[model samples]
Target: MRFFLEFLEFLENMQLMLIINTIMKMPTVTKIIYRLKDEGLLDTRICDNDNRVTQVSLTEQGWTMVEKINEIASLLLTDSFTGLKPNDIKKLNEYLKILKANLQ
Candidate 1:
């Protein structure tokens, strides 16, 4: 249960960072804006010239929380991949790639 929660945190934290960085750089996405606001991870402001447009920026508390979650996830990842032969590791990676492709 703890591991599952950690994994969830890992996904959420990565997603938060991706959204934050993407919003900082390129074209804005509605999903990112909704997610950030829904999660209370960031704030948004609408431009007057483009009322449909939103600008997103992370809050300090959000950054701190995501950072801690990322740290915990990193620790869990390091600890979880403890025992595996070389062939097993290769097979695992291959299977994961296949699974990801299938999902896409």
Candidate 2:
């Protein structure tokens, strides 16, 4: 499954409960958030207006890691497709489309 954390780049911060309820429904999301916070990738603080709410934001290290992950993903994708000709890519695209249709 695609991770909700993948879209964290777009938001400044998010509430713990909102992240669990709105973005990820699984109970393990709480564990993941706690793990990220413990690893120092995410910083969590009690909300100013509401002490009950915990706000989570990426730390400097987290942002750096995210950038690196994106860079690596891009490089891996480019390397994987490097030797393919135009027709090869077109045929691969057709196969991907059929695969997607079947999945759907």
Listed per model in order, the count of residue pairs whose N, CA or C atoms clash below 3 Å is 0, 0
List of clashing residue pairs for candidate 2 = none
TM-scores of all candidate predictions against the true structure = 0.54, 0.71
- The list of candidate 1 runs beyond 4 A from truth reads 1-40, 85-87, 101-104
- Point out the worst 10-residue segment of candidate 1 by lDDT: 1-10
lDDT of 2 by residue, 1-104 (tens): 12434556666554446645775665676677788888878888888999877777888977887888788889998999999998999999999999999999
The 0-to-1 C-alpha lDDT of every candidate, in the order given, reads 0.60, 0.74
Q: Compare the candidates by TM-score and give the number of the best one.
A: 2
Candidate 2 segments exceeding 4 Å error: 1-5, 13-23, 49-52
Q: 1-104, model 1: which lDDT tens digit per residue?
A: 23322333444434443544543543344554566567776676775687755545556656666677779878997777778777988999999999999999
